[model samples]
Target: MRKEIHLEHSSLKYPLPEQFVQELSEELAFMNEYPSGGSYKTLSAKLAEYTDIAPDCILPANGSDEVIESITRAFGNRLILIPIPTFSQYEVSAERNGLNKKFVPCLEGHNYRLVYCEEDLKKASLIWICNPNNPTGSSIPREEIKRVLDIAPGIVAVDECNYEYLGESVVDLIEQYPNLAISRSFSKNFGLAGLRLGFAVSSSKNIVEIARYGQHFRVNKMAERAGIKVLKYLDYFQNIWQEIARTRDFFIAGLKGLNIMVLPSKTNFVLVDFTTEEKARKIWNFLRGEKVFTVAGWEQEFSGLDNQYLRFTISNQEEMSFVLELLKRFPENTS
Candidate 1:
């Protein structure tokens, strides 16, 4: 059987710290018990310590997906503004709650930077910003986010699930701006995607409201224990994050050497622009035949450009080198 390489979902290629195995083993006996409800006090406290925020300001969920949904339901009664060619969940949550949504197109010529007009800012009650955005892997500037918060009448929820890769955050502004809520996940940096641990950080009041739409005991025990244990090993994951960054840069250089147009990324993935759908499909199909799977841009609802793009997750140097070699030998379309 051929070994398959999956670059579709952006989960980290590294494994969690070895200590987690013992942690989960200890949690196994408690599988019969239900998790604590009402925002999961202990888990929230651990997350609070990790994020350097008040315990009351943390709301643990199944994952960032649930966090986004809760934030959308809690504050998305009015119009919600989402920048396009970004994460699809922002749109999914808005539509699921039956709230009105506006898709703001990010500037394609400008590294896909997010731009919001004063009119849209004032009209929106909820604005979703995916920092180091998914698929595009582009980061929104701190000043830009602050500018939006200054004028936007409602919540500005920034998804920082990939923040560890870039080491940038606006979490400190949560105290200054009551409307700011940041969603983070343990999936990418912590290598705990299977455990499904994520949380929302904001003002204590905002957290209380976000908690309302959530069901009781949404976070399971294994995930709770894992979240606490992982906080102790930030140094371990920080090393891995640095390694991924290095690997990402190497991969980007290799792609560029192939004369491919690759987008700049702060996240753990790179977006490749093939300039046209035909070429993109050809490359994607070729890679798939080689047991290497990548994500196509249109599949993620990437808008504002006809150029077909593909996103590849960064792994170690050997795997990336393998990919580059595959691209080097990509079978030509003779048709």
Candidate 2:
């Protein structure tokens, strides 16, 4: 049987908009026509309106990965700076491009949060940052982000895939800093992971350069309609996100009660350290036996965690409560 509880990956587990599902179904008629590729014009305008950025500065892609890949292709010739234990893909991308890469660890004992040294900041060409970072879920301060922009030697690519909960953004900095690009995802916030839709915000000149590597028939028509509906009822979506954040706090508190060490987070997930890699694997096995799914911290991207953590994506309160109950019954490791 399939896993009964899914706390794996950072994707939102709640249902997508009912109306969007209907619209996506009805809009399937446009399947015969080609997708607009990386330059979904109207969608770019919608993103621009939502972000308060210029349409010419936005590039809507099939997914945020496309936007990131475009960054690698456009600026792959230089050194790339990445924060360790954030997302593994940035390292993979850098390696694929044969670009020199540096993985800077955050301030000592900051739970793998982002911290940059001035000297290290001046040595790279492209800096990759994942706010409310993926595996760790640690949110770096806004001022620190501004500092990176001010000091970084070259382009800084900020992946704000989980940006909604922060209530503040450096996206506005894109216009002022031609060296910055902010990539956002609809998959997590809009509940559109199935569509694989995302967009990027940057200076007009920066986007123009990224768009040159953009290809055709990238975004599907149904996904486009769903994306439009999401923007149209954005307030409703925002409210839903607020609820998720509330649930996240509740889940963190519940985990703490179980003697688990949870990293602070402003995102929909939290990193729970089991104090040791062996303990983590034990709990992972216990949960897997119960058919609940979650991310084991052994992933190389999260090596900074020393395989001692688990990243649990938040679901509804009911689902979370059930998981917590199961975890309560977990045998304590005295090892």
Candidate RMSDs in order? 1.9, 1.9
Q: Spell out the clash pairs found in candidate 1.
A: none
Deviation in Å, model 2, residue 289 alpha carbon: 0.3
Name the candidate that leads on lDDT: 1
Each candidate structure's TM-score, on Cα atoms with residue i matched to residue i, is: 0.96, 0.94
> Which 10-residue window of candidate 2 scores lowest in summed lDDT?
297-306
Local error of candidate 2 at 294, Å? Answer: 0.7
| Candidate 1 per-residue C-alpha lDDT over 184-215 given as tens digits, one digit per residue, 9 for 90 to 100 | 99998888898898899999999889988888
Cα lDDT of all candidates, in order?
0.86, 0.79
How many steric overlaps does candidate 1 have? 0
Model 1, CA-based lDDT: 0.86
